[model samples]
Every structure is written in structure tokens, then in C-alpha cells.
Target chain A: MTIEHSILGVIASRPCTGYDIKTEFEHEGAGMVWGVSFGSVYPKLKSMEEQGLIQNYRTETKGRMKKMYELTPKGWEALHKWLGELPSYPSIKDELLLKLSMWDRGRPEDRQTLIYHMKNRKEQSQELLDYYLQWPQNGHSSISEFGMLGIQYVQERLETELRWIEKAILQLEGEPQPPVQDPYDLIPKQQERRNLAINPPVITVHPESSTDEDRV
Target chain B: MTIEHSILGVIASRPCTGYDIKTEFEHEGAGMVWGVSFGSVYPKLKSMEEQGLIQNYRTETKGRMKKMYELTPKGWEALHKWLGELPSYPSIKDELLLKLSMWDRGRPEDRQTLIYHMKNRKEQSQELLDYYLQWPQNGHSSISEFGMLGIQYVQERLETELRWIEKAILQLEGEPQPPVQDPYDLIPKQQERRNLAINPPVITVHPESSTDEDRV
Candidate 1:
């Protein structure tokens, strides 16, 4: 549903071929917000035209014929309707979070490797955020004001992730447990053995800060 | 790939029927990390069993037959292999971000509606964070320490989102444009109309904060 509306919205701004639409999404301004492959765009364009939401005309560029699409009245109406409706909740699939969830079940080396990877991730995020901060100087129009805001939003998200990674590394360092225990050893060899029998591990709970309640 | 490792990791901790595995995922500890519907789980389990990564046996309980799965040696090897490998980068498909990208093209009423929806989203995120904060009191074991960290990660993410939304609202409020012009009016009725002649609205660039550079 979002892809359909996003494509329509882009076309409503100006007439473009399917290839043009794909290129626009790959550009810095719209890339992160509405990235899609040629595989998805071609079929959607054909279907939207068949549904009379968009109309296409043949144009010659560089002595080659290309079909360019523009929003019909129906397409404009559909785009407006979508804008008025509330969007569905975003579902996240954070792979790093998935790995972190099971980190305690890994060996000490695995944990170290995870930390190393996280540091690399932190650097990558910083690079992306830096690139986004330069969007204003690139001469994007007032109509792209919202797009710039979206970039700022992503920048904040990356910042938060970097902080979390630092905190996690600290927590791992402060852990009182012995280093490099095999995960298989954490499980008892016999059915009667229990986790508590292995060690009297000290658990540190983060103290609740006053700031925790400030946002809520 | 994460799901396959997640399933193996769960089974390695303890043997369980597919029904039991489903229940575990719906439970508080594992639910957030590896949420999957029965439709995906069942097929994945069948294929994994055929590939010799997992094996199953029938057990009768309460006059009914239940098929339980356990990790084979190969499955254990596979899980460990995955743990040693670097995780894939998380790909986000944020619908709200998508809407925000095109927000400048929306009507005044549409922008107001978006603000309302963002507020609602903020509340929902707060509720989830609050629920996660209570995990320590619920007696999750030391092995779930990483899981607890993951909850904190999500909580911080939600808080960041809320802050961004507030900032976004302020930016929208400070917009100098007149209220409620038809979007079509922004476009030229004549074919030759170029975008720049539409008053070239001033875009207020956000000032760079010292904190932004501190992370990098």
C-alpha cells in the first residue's frame, strides 16, 4: 500500500518513466524513505495504468522511445486519500538486536566478536548521519523540506543506537562472571544439574534515573 | 537466517514440540526477539528436519500425539557457526518516515492528521517501554541479561523517536507558509511551469549542535 502511494506521489510531482522513478528513489533525498527495485516498480506502473490511476505517453529521448507516467485525476485522488489516513505501525526487524538477545548464550570469544562488530556498526552509522547533514547545502527545494526532516529523524535514530552500543559494551566489561565459558558448559551435563549450581553470579540492575520518567 | 538460528538456539536449550516452541516465542522473554507466526514456523521446521539440522520424535500426552523437535549435532554446529559470523545490517521499513518524506505535498489537514498520529505512536512506544522495564522484577534468569539489554535498546530507540517527533512538530508549527493551499495550485496549470517561480519559499536550516559532532 505504501509503495503504491509513494510511486503515485512521486509521479504526481512530475511525469517520469519507470526508470526515472527508480533513479529518484536511489538519490540521496528519497533513497532511504522509498527505496525500491526495478522488479517492483515496473509491475506497479503497469498495474496502476491498467487501473486508470496513472496514464502513460510515449516520449523520445536520445532517439529512443520511452514510456513516461503521470498521475491521472484518479491517481491524485488516491494519493490524497492515503495522505489523510493514519499510517500503520512500523514493524522492525533489527538483526543486531536479535543477536544481542541471545548474546548470553554465546561463548566469550563470540561476545568479543559481537562487540567488535558493534563498533564497526557505530562508525558506519556515523558516516551515514554525516552524509545526511549536508542535504541542506545541496539546493533541494522547499518542497523537499519534509524530506530533510526525515533525514534528521534518521540521524537521531543512529545516534541513539550508537549510545546503546557504548552502554552495552560497558555492561559487558563490568560483568563479574569469568571469561570464555562455553555455552554448552552453561547447560548441565546431567538432568539434575541446574544453572545456579555453576556459580553465584552477581547481577547488576541499572539504577532508574529521573530522566527515564521525563519523556513518558 | 536469524529465524533458523533462533529456532536452533531455543531447541538447544531444551527439546520441545513445535507447539511448545510457538508458546515460548509468545512468552515475554523470547517473544520480542524471535516473533514468528505459525505459518512460517511450521514450514521452516519441516524443511530443517528434512535437511538433518533437526530431528523429531512423537510423544503421546493426554491421549493425543505430539511431535517434538530437538537439535541434532549438525544443528548445534549450525547455530555456533551463525553465532561466530557478523550479523547482517538491520534494514528499516518505517512507514511513518515514508509519509514524513512526502509531507510537504500534503494538505494542511493531512499534516494535522499526521501530527495526531505521531502523538498516538509516541504513546504506544511509551507503553511498550514501560512494560519492558518491569522485566527484572519478573525473575528472568542471568542468561537473559542480553535480552534485558535489548529491551533497554528498544526503550532508548522509542525515546529518540519521541524526541524527533516533538522537534518535527515544532518545525511544522514554525513553517511560514499560509494555511491550506490546494496542492494542485502549487503546480502550474500550463505545461511550461517550472518549480522555482512558485515564490521560492525560504527553508530554515536546523543549526548544528555540538552534541551532533561529539558522537562522530
Candidate 2:
């Protein structure tokens, strides 16, 4: 859904109330892959309303107020007909890889902390997969099939990522411990070391092996 | 440092002008795993200047003008502070996954097209890795280390994705042919047939035969 810009595409298929759209979102497997919360949806709907991409009407039904939404003709045209291009592949902005880039700059202990974090994240992904699989498949069968495919796709990819993370951990674990460098012992080639202002070198240490390093 | 945001963080360590910054970005293994263009960088620098995050001075040397850039105190503060936070993990959002998700909606020809696209993408990733390895590794030791790490990571991940693509192609290839359904095949039970619209009809065919019925 995120890949296809399908949320808008799906909504544009017909006029629907907010609840109806939410039902479609959950049942059609879109939610399984491109997650959205009520918090996210309502705001987006309101914004779309403001943009005149969609319109809404309020009605009283069985003593309850219902707000229904519909794509304007322009919005429908924009969704199915316009097809403005977006980047084909999604780019990652992951921070863990950045930490790995700077891992050598830190103490051996600091690097180990990053490894632990990745291990924990991998475990959580597996747990989520298990929970997703346990969902009952008793109703909305077509939607269920679609939802299952999306879930399976995510789970399989996560498993692959775990394999990478495990390999990375192993590599980091096998690396020789970085030797501590003493600022006083290593002098500059031309400039007098004393002439440069040296901030008290705070060494990052392994969170487990060196408790003092974790004071912050 | 797409994953780490480390490229920019490292740059913020000292003030240098745009050209100097570009050199640093290129030398730091950034181009290997991630990319930034003069178009992106110049605009960002201009924005940052407006935001007071960076300051620049024009200096003339050897009859040429050079603009030197340095982080404002705020920029240095922001950089060091962000350094304490862990970098995000990388994620791949392959378009191939999107096409695969809607395989049931596509014609057999579409499936083959998807397979071809995946194969091409896999080959492209591999070729990129190979080209990166041929790049000269001298003078810039840390950046070279980054390049080596990036090559290893990308190559391994691409191999895993390629295996999945191969499996999908094989599965589709081995599908048993279906006894094609006709518009007027038989009189249907109104209730059951109505229910069928809510649930896609399952494909039943010889294990190795191609089937027109829904597979997903």
C-alpha cells in the first residue's frame, strides 16, 4: 500500500464514510503492510477535505451521526488517471548503521551496546510475526488472503534482516578489542599537544563490562 | 551513512565550505552506501545558512574566491548531541514486492514482467557492488573501511533477495494449468455465489500446471 500509494487509490474507488474506509483498510491487507492509526487517518482525511481532494457530508442514522466522505471528481481523476510518479524504491534512514559507521570511534564496550540493541530489535520482529500469524482467518476470506500475503512478505523480509544482524553481531564479536588510546601518550607531529585545547577525553566503554562508562 | 546520519555529523565536527564539505562527504564512504548531489547539498546549505545553523565567509586566495563554512555553536551542539543517539537501521522498500503482492490481479504476462524486473534489479545491485570494489582505496583509511563494509553488506543482502525472486519465479513457472472457467459454466446457488464475491475462488490444478484461478 505504501509502495503503491494505494491508500488514496483504494479510497477513491467509491464514496465511503470514515468507518467504511477504516474497515476496508483493515480487511484488505493494506494495514498489514502500510500501518496507519486512527490518529493518522482522521487527520489525513481532514487535510484531504481541506485540499478539496475529498468532500464529506454528515447524516443522522438511527440516532447516530455519521460523516461520509467521497472523492471529488478531480480527486478521482488525480488518483486513477494522473499517476504522477514517485520514487520506485524506498530509501532507509536507519540510525543503527550510522552507529556502526562510528563504532570504531567508540570503546569496544560501546560497539557491543549497538549489537545488543539490534539483537533485541530482531527478536521483537519475530514476536510480531508470530502474533500476526495467530490472527483468526474465519471471515472476510479474500481480504484475509491479501492480508496474509502482506504479513508474510514483512515477516520473511524481517527474517532476512535478522540473518544480516546476526552476521554483523558475529563479525563485531570476533573483532579484536579496540585498544584504549591515551591522549597524553599520543603527541601531534608538528603542533605542541599542550597548545591545543583537549576536552577531557571521555571513553565510551562496554555497558556490561564497564559500569562507570554508563553513568550518563 | 544513510543508516547512521554519520556523514553530516562527521562534517559538523569542523567548519568547511561547500566544496570542502563535498570532498569530505565523498571521501567518507558516503557515495558507496548513500548519495548526495550538489543540487541537494547546496540547497541544504543555503537553508541551513538561513536557519543560522552554519556560517560562511568568502576569502580570496590565488585570485580565486572561496567560501569557507563552519558550524555555528548551535550546529556543533546539535551534531554532538545527535551523536549520542543511535542511528536508525536500514530498510529496503523494493517495488518488486509491491508487484508481487497483487500477483492475483495481474495477467500471466504481468507476472513474467515482474520476474524480469526483479532479475534486472538483482543484477544491477551486484554490478554496483563490483564497481565499488574496483574504486581506488588510498589515503582515506576510514572512508575506505566504510566502502569495504558497504560492499560486503549490499552484496550479501542482494544475494538473499535474489534467492527469494528465484523461488517466486520457480513457483509461478511450476503452476498447473487451470480448466478455464466460463461465464456461463453452470447455474450457481445465489447465496453461495454471492458469498464467493467476498472470498476469492481458490485455484485447484495439477501441482505443476499453470492455473488462471487465484493463487494469492
Candidate 3:
């Protein structure tokens, strides 16, 4: 979704400046999930204002002036509708998995690099989850609740990924042990061999010596 | 990356027509990770040929003609550079987390939706990973290796996420018992209050008298 919708969602609750929205990301732990940048937020907010979804007003605070934003009636309606239609779950477009699909053709070193990156991410995710639990944020439980939830989500995913990395590392080392069944299992069955011969049958005897019965 | 690059990487391993590339994604296991469509592959092949990354030739076979493609030296170089460059790891941009981040101001129902969404995603991810691992590949260890690596990565992440979902569900239910704490520990120290008074302390007389005069 566009940053506009995200910022509007924030503004829908209460009026805020672009800086306020940026600060809100850190304050509310949005950085942990959405990863919005001020660069994208401000421009999108301006465009939203232009589109009449939000309205801006100048306000003086401690001898400084700032443009604070508020959702317009239209914006409120739009945000409400958006919220109503919001998908129940998160949609992920993971580029790493996409790259892994081509791993067979990729250089072994590249696969190693991907594994290395995931390892670091996994550790970071685990640490963050631990840190969240250690903090014991009671006063801001309202906010921390979500942060805790996200940290939990991320940490679990990371740990799962670390296992995959270890497995990948093992696989890259060499071909895994093959099953120790009879090697003949790898060969085709007799009926299939007979069918293959019949399709393009080669005569052991010369064609001139072959009788009609042999040909048949 | 673009589908063209993905196609290029696949073709660089061996000459293949657009149909072959499509088949690679469809019939082969490539679709599990690297997805490409026939409509896209044909256009990209045309573009690559025009750019000299590949060359096409036609051959007659049993009164029929077949078009074949082979990578040019330039294509190999391009693929080489792509392989050498840094690979981007997967990014999870979950919008539900965005909503959950706002749970502080959101209605309880919204938070409930977010929780349920995460739980569903956890289940779905696990299912997909399990399905990917069901096949028993014997000879192509590389494919099996990378395939399992990708699947396990996602599977472990799902388990991690499931834990988070459980945590969130508990929090939404109540204060989560503030985790467990041993009563044997000494009472925690009180935090010092910050001084934010607008005016300095007043030099007022004591209720009974002046403090200095009383001491004298």
C-alpha cells in the first residue's frame, strides 16, 4: 500500500504534523514493522492534502510554526472504508526466496552470501524479541503490546530462518547422503525397456536374413 | 530483479527457448521460488535477443522447424556480473503489523483481526513449507538442497510467528500476568521524579514561624 494510506491511517485517529507522523513511527514502534521513511511520508502527506483527503493548518508553538495535518471528512470516510476493507492478514513479497529459486544456477558463493545475510537477520530478530520482553513496559502497555507482538512474530520467523541457514550450509558442503537402497532402483523397469526397443527396434540379425515373422 | 534477469540466469546455464523457460517455471520446481509467466518470458527473450544477450536459430526436423536459443558471450558476462553483485535478502512488509502498531488507539476488534491474521499466516506458511518438502529427490541434490533450505527457512519462521501469535492473543486477552517474577527479589527502587516546575521554589515562611529565627 501507499505511504499515503498509512499516514492517513495515523492521521485518522488524530491530527498530526508530518514530523509528528515520522516521530510516531518511532514512538509507536512502526519502524519495527512498516519501515516508513520521512522521505516517503512527507511527500505522500502533501499529495494526500492536495487530493483533499487531508487538510493542513499552520500552528505556532514556542515561537516556532509547524504545519499540522488533520483528516478531512473525505479522508475520514476514505480511511474508514479502507480500514473496513483492510485485509485480515499481511501479504509478503519476499525477494530473498525469489533469489533462492534460482539458487541452482547461482554461484555457490552467492548462495553462501544469502545464507550469511539471513543468519544476521535471524540473530537480530531474536535479540529484539528478547529485549522487548526484558523491558517490561507497563505504562505504555497499550503501545508496547503491539511492539511485543511484532517482536514475537519477527523473532520466531528469524529462528526458523536460522535453522534453514544451517541446513543450507550443510547442503552446500556436499551432496547429502543418498538412500542406501539397491542401485537397481535407479534403473527403468523391464516392460518400459521392451516398449523403448519396440518403438525403435534394432535387429541383431541382418535385415536380409530377417523373416516376416521376425519383423512382425 | 526483473524476470529478464531471472530468464537470463536460467538460460545462461544452457540454451533454452522461451517455451523452455516457461516450462522450467511451470513443470519444474522453479515456480516455487522464481515465478515467471509465458507472456513475460517471450517478451524478455525478444528483448534479450535484440540486445545481443542471446541469439536464436531455427532447424528443420521431420518437415517441422524448431526455434532454439543460446546465450551470447555478452549474456554470459551479464549473468556473471549479476551473480557477483550483492543479493538482496527477503523483506517482510506486513501491513497488519502496521494496524497492530496502532492498536493503542484502535478498537479491540481491530487488534483481534490482526491477531487472527498472524495466526492464519503462521499456519499457511507452515503448510506451504511442508508441501515443498514432501518430494523425495534422489539425484539432483543441488535442487533438493536449496529447495529444502528455502522451505525450512520459511517453516522455522512460521513456528516463530506462531509463538508471537500466541503471545499477542494472550496480551489481547489480559495483562499476560506481567510474565513471571520471583517474590524473593528485593523491592525495586523508586524512580527519581524529574523537575519541571515553571517557577523557582518560593522562600516562604514556615507555618509556625521562620525556620532560621526558630532555630536561633
The lDDT for every candidate, in the order shown, is 0.67, 0.49, 0.56
Tens-digit lDDT track for model 1 on A1-216?
A: 678888976776678899988887776543256478999999999999999988899999999999998776667667767877777666565667767766545443355777776777777777776776665454443235566567778878878988888988887666534422225444333112213323323454654543445444
Better of 1 and 3 by DockQ: 1
| Top-DockQ candidate index | 1
Residue range with the least summed lDDT across 10 consecutive positions in model 1 chain A: A190-199
Candidate 1, clashing residue pairs? none
Residue-by-residue lDDT tens digits, candidate 3, A1-216: 546667876675456788888876653452244456789888888788899888889999998998988766576556545544444444344545645544444443344565565556556555655655554443332333454565556555555665666666666565543322223432123224323423545655667776668755
Pick the TM-score winner: 1
DockQ, all candidates in order: 0.19, 0.12, 0.15
Interface RMSD of each: 6.8, 8.9, 10.4
lDDT (Cα, tens digit) per residue for candidate 1, span B1-216: 677877876776677787777776765543255477888888999999999988899988999998988776677667666776777666566677777766555443345777776777777767766766665455442345565677788778877887888888777666544412224444333122222323333444754543445544
Give the distance in Å from residue A200's predicted Cα in candidate 2 to where it truly belongs: 10
Candidate order by TM-score, decreasing, is 1, 3, 2
Off by over 4 Å in 3: A12-14, A19-40, A61-64, A86-99, A108-147, A170-216, B12-43, B57-70, B104-106, B109-123, B135-144, B166-216
lDDT per residue, candidate 2, B151-214, as tens digits? 4555555556556656655655565332122133221222233234335466656655746542
Highest lDDT model number = 1
CAPRI docking class of candidate 1: incorrect
The RMSD of every model to the true structure, in order and in angstroms, is 15.3, 11.9, 13.7
